[model samples]
Target chain A: MAKPDLIIIGAGPAGMAAAATAANGGLKVHLLDDQPAAGGQVYRNITRNQDRLTHLGPEYTKGIPLADALDHPNITHVAGAAVWRIDDTPTVWYSLHGKSHAIHADHVLIATGAQERPVPFAGWTLPGVMPAGAAQILMKSSDLLPKDAVLAGSGPLLYLIAVQMIEAGQPPVAMVETQTPQMMMRAVRHLPRALLDRQQIFKGLAMLRKIRAARIPRYTAAHSFKAQIQDDLLDFEFTSKGETHHLKCALVLSHQGIIPATHLTRSAGIPHKWHKAQQCWHPDHDTEGRTARPGLWVAGDSAGILGADAARAQGVITANAIICAVRGLRPSIASHVNAHAINHRNRAQAIRAFLDAAYAVPPEINTPPDDTILCRCEEITAGTIRQAIHDGATELRHLKTATRIGMGPCQGRQCDLSLTHMLAAQTQRPIATVGMPRARSPVRPVSLGEIAALEQTD
Target chain B: MMTDSRFFRRENGTYDTVCLQIDGVQTHARATDTVAAALLAFGPAPTRTTGISQSPRTPFCMMGACFDCLVTIDGRPNQQACMITVQDGMCITHQAGFRPLEEPHDG
Candidate 1:
């Protein structure tokens, strides 16, 4: 096989758009994703789940065209491929169908998308509890609904999932929201800029209205959310408005918000800084998605927490930059498509401040109480992490060594965000200074049989 | 057996149903269904037990980030059910306790 001019990881909104744009400009692009299909998490199963289009909403439908455009002759779409390593040689190594393969490219774009912030709490490891995003994936991909489900935690996605469930005729029993009144008050300052994006404002309003119309009981300013298995059924409890309430349900879906998935980027030795407003570490990159390292670029939520719309726009801009460098053209040359994508991205991102302020992941969820299990793999509790810190484990790496906090199979993907916050809070240090566990490969667990099956080739 | 009220097949869609074995019980699922979805539809039982604590765990994040959905499939232990599609006649068993490491052999 011949080496492609460009390789893009993650076939999500950003990677899909980037591949199409670059391939159209006469570059051979190889687009790879871990999913069985082209659509990423947001647009997952867009082409296959045709029976439930109305239930998925318009945001999902937009992926249909992008998935189609990925079929351009110059773009080689590789699905069900897990990329486990990238090196300074600018080489990409991945495992596919139980075999390992390597490819070289002049440029590589990391468009890996986001994952729901892990909100650890009491009974979170129970069989009935799961992230709201997980429930959304089941509904979108397999048409699985959460029977007798109760939505909990805070963020736009919580509301979005509630609305989607309602549309599908399986609304949750109630929604337990964690955003406090003070947060809403702080968000008021950004309302003027937020309203400028009339479409998003109206869409959010419509979701809220539907939830209200469906009469799904909503508890605002809820705290101390917990789930317990009693009499073989899941029982949920939380404190709202200074009153504790309890309910029995079959499923408990939770979400705090989302953070950029930085495992691959961090593992590649990219520079990252703590994003105060978003409360996560984001890779440092310029407007056109060029990273500090040459021959590499990052677009979409992996770079930061920009949504799908901005992700597509950023993908276009990044592809333009790549084309300019490869063709020896002036960087000043901005095409009409590039200008439009920039405007759209700017408009979409204008509401980020308001959204962040309104739906920040509460501190309690970030650093759960003592008994809560912080690491599911090792079964380590919050108190264990705190004790590790008290025992002179200052940084995340130190804590990992002491308590094995992130040494499980998931490889810190499930615990890294919350662990960083807990470390900062317990040690009285800034999150940036506390730092995250450095990402390593194989990023995802690849079986030894698969590795041995790899054929040695140049 | 628990009824799968959460998911229903679209009658008009042209998709085939495949039969698979879950814990020695025969179950039917759509060709497009993932192992996690098929197991969820089959019953409300936990997918597996934790390696250390032995606590029953189910699919927490069906998108592959959370490893709670790991199950033994076709004699292979610790395969992510959410990431793989269900195949006809596939045998799946709930993973329990710690999975034993492969014994080393002299080269």
Candidate 2:
């Protein structure tokens, strides 16, 4: 296969935007993603020949504009391709359907987005517990609900999904959010920025308004303390405004916020920066998303959690920078796209900055009160990790190896960031300094029989 | 909505019979359901715990991707409760350390 001039690692908002902008800039672009669809987590598409329009709602359909870009002859969308390793010579190596493919490019854009932060608690292993993103995925892919659910955790996504459930005509019983007043106060610092685009702010506010209209109690300053399974229903205890309350529901949805997906970047030997406020490791980038390594750029949530609008602008900005690098000077169109791009970025940044402050990791996440367990896989507890740390397990890698923290299934996608945040905060080390574990091929574990069958094919 | 019925398996065991041990407590679990489903059939909603600060965590994503449902089953640690089937005389324990000793090592 002919090597494209540029390779984009993700097919999400940033990758799609980057591909479109790059192709429009006259560069040969190849876009790849592990999923069959291009839209990332936020705009996930239904795969079973059904209309994603009905399954995922309108915001997802907005991605249709970029999806149309796939029709461009210069852009080759390689769906189901998982980029496992970036060689020492910068050759991109990926595996798909048990086969390997390699691409050599002058430039690469890492747009692999973030994953959800796992907040482990007792009874998390019960049949009904699931990440808010998973619920959103199921809703998008299958048009199904968890059937009588209680949603908890901190972040706008939480309320958004709750409202989505209501709109889907399967409103959850209650929404238990852990957004503290202090966090809201921190968020006020960006009020001027948030106020810039009243439409964006109103969109978020509208969801809240709808939740209230549905009489679904929005419980702020609340935490899902503990849960017990009772007759196939989850019974939960939560504290709100210093009062403890109990409720019963069939499912629980939760997440703190998103972290940059560092697996590909880390595997490629790209350096990272730890944003304490975001409590996640982000790729170090210039204003245009150029990483420390030449010919490599990162944009969107892959760099950090700047919402979709910021992601689009950042993608464009990064493509412009790549064009400039290729031509050895700024393109004439740079002047044309610069002003609008800057405006979009500034507007997106305002809301993102507020969101960063508003959704800062709560105190509970760092130091889950002693009774909470940290590793549910091995029944590992917070006390145990602390004891191990006290026993001189200094680094995250050491702690992980010593305590089997990230070794569980799910490939540490869930607890890795939360663990990094806690360890970074405790040890006073930057989260960037902490090493992110690499994602191996067959990213999702397959059975031995499946592996044997693949070997036979080869 | 058509679910992949292949993912759902039916067992002939009685749903009401069988005593299981969840972290040293003699709990009742059904052989016909998944460990997670059986646990949910009981009183405690969360079957596992967090590694940092030992906060109580329940399975939020039951599809087996969240890693929140890790538990020590029989002698294995970090086993996903949602993906594993329930059986009689299963000894399930709570995971408690950053690296639980029972973790399956591919290293």
Candidate 3:
């Protein structure tokens, strides 16, 4: 296969937009994703989910056009491809259909998107406790609804899932909000700028109203939330406004917002810096998504925790940048797309600050009680991590060597962010100084058989 | 246990159904359904057990991030049920604890 001019490694909002824009610019583009479809997690199953479009809302239906655009003749779309290794030579190795394949590209775009921040508390590894985003995926992909579900934690997604569930005729039993009144007050300062996006603000208010109308026992100022498995059911308990409340439910879905999934970028030897406000490490990139690496670019949530709309805008801007470089044209060539994206993205950023403040991941959720399991794969506890730190394991890599905190199949995708915060708090250091565990390839786990087969085919 | 049939069904579109075997029982599922979704529609039973605690677990993140939904399919251990789509006559087992690793032999 001939090397494509550009390779976009995720078919989500950013990736699809980048592919479409670059291909339309007369560049040969290759777009690959692990999912069987084009839409990333947010717009997953957009085509097949026509039956449940009303339940999923407009945010989902918008993905249909993006998915359709991926079918552009100049773009080669590959689905169900698990990219395991990206080398400095700018070659991407992915395993698909039980075989491995490699492709070289002049420019690579990392738009892998984000994942729900891991919130580890007591009994989080229990059968019934899960991230609220996971519940949303089930509903989006297969229309699976939790029969007796309780939504907990603090974020816009928490309420969005609750409202979606209500639309599905299976409203959650209750919602336990971890945000305090003080946080809302702090967020109020940014409301003027946030309200500029009146449609989003109104949508949020309507969801809140619907939740109230549905009478889904909403608790505010909820903290110290814990879940335990008792006789095949989840016993969820939390403190709300000085009162300890307990509820038995079949499922406990929790969320603390999302963070950029930087594993791919980090593994590719790109530089990352901690965003203090967003509370996560993002790839060090310029406004046009150009990283320090000569031929690589980072866009979408992978660069930072921007939402899908901003991701789409950033994708267009990055593609324009890539086109300028590939065609040896001046940066001034794509100035129009850059200007429009910058304006749209700045608007999104205005509201993001308020959302970040209003639904910040609680400190307690990040550094759970000592005995809480920190790493689900290794079953390592927060106490063990603390012990490792006390033993002079100052950095994440040091802690991994001492306690094996992130040496699991999931490759720290589930625990890295929480561990970074936990380490910073325990050692009284800034989160950026604490640093993240060094990323290694293959970024995703690949079977030995697949690796061996690659050699034979070569 | 109440099945997911009443809770989830295609409202307007039609898709072909395929038969698969789950834990020794024959089950019917849509071709578009993922392994996790097919098993979920059967019931809310635990899909697998934890490696260290031996506690029951289900599909937490329907995406590939969480490894909670690992199951044995077609004799391959530790396959992500959420990532793979269902196919007719495929055999799946609810994994319990860790599958002992096989010793490597000289090539």
User: Could you report the DockQ of all the candidates, in the order they appear?
Assistant: 0.54, 0.12, 0.49
Q: Residue A239 lDDT in model 2? A: 89
Candidate 2, residue A417: lDDT: 64
Question: How would the docking of model 1 be graded?
Answer: medium
Which candidate number maximizes TM-score? 1
What is the interface RMSD, in angstroms, for predicted model 1?
2.9
DockQ of model 1, rounded to 2 decimals: 0.54
Cα TM-score per model: 0.97, 0.78, 0.96
Worst 10 residues of 1 chain A by lDDT: A449-458
Number of the predicted model whose DockQ against the real structure is largest = 1
Candidate 1 has what TM-score?
A: 0.97
Clashes of 2: 56
Prediction 3 global C-alpha lDDT: 0.85
TM-score order, best first, reads: 1, 3, 2
Q: How many backbone overlaps does candidate 1 show?
A: 0
lDDT by residue for model 1 over A1-458, one digit each (tens)? Answer: 77788899999999999999999999999898999998899999987864356876888888989888998999999898898988886888888877888888879999999988888999999977889899898887877778899999988999999988888788899999999999999999999999879889889899999999999999999999889988777889999999999989888999988899888889888899899989988899988888877788999999999899999988889998899877888877745548988998999888898999999878898889999998999999999998888888878888898989889988998899889999888878888888888899889778777677666333
Cα lDDT computed for each candidate against the true fold: 0.87, 0.69, 0.85
Over the true interface, candidate 2 deviates by an RMSD, in Å, of 9.9
Candidate 2 residue runs with Cα over 4 Å from true position: A46-57, A331-336, A376-379, A424-458, B1-107
Ranking by lDDT: 1, 3, 2
Model 3: residue A442 alpha-carbon error in angstroms: 0.4
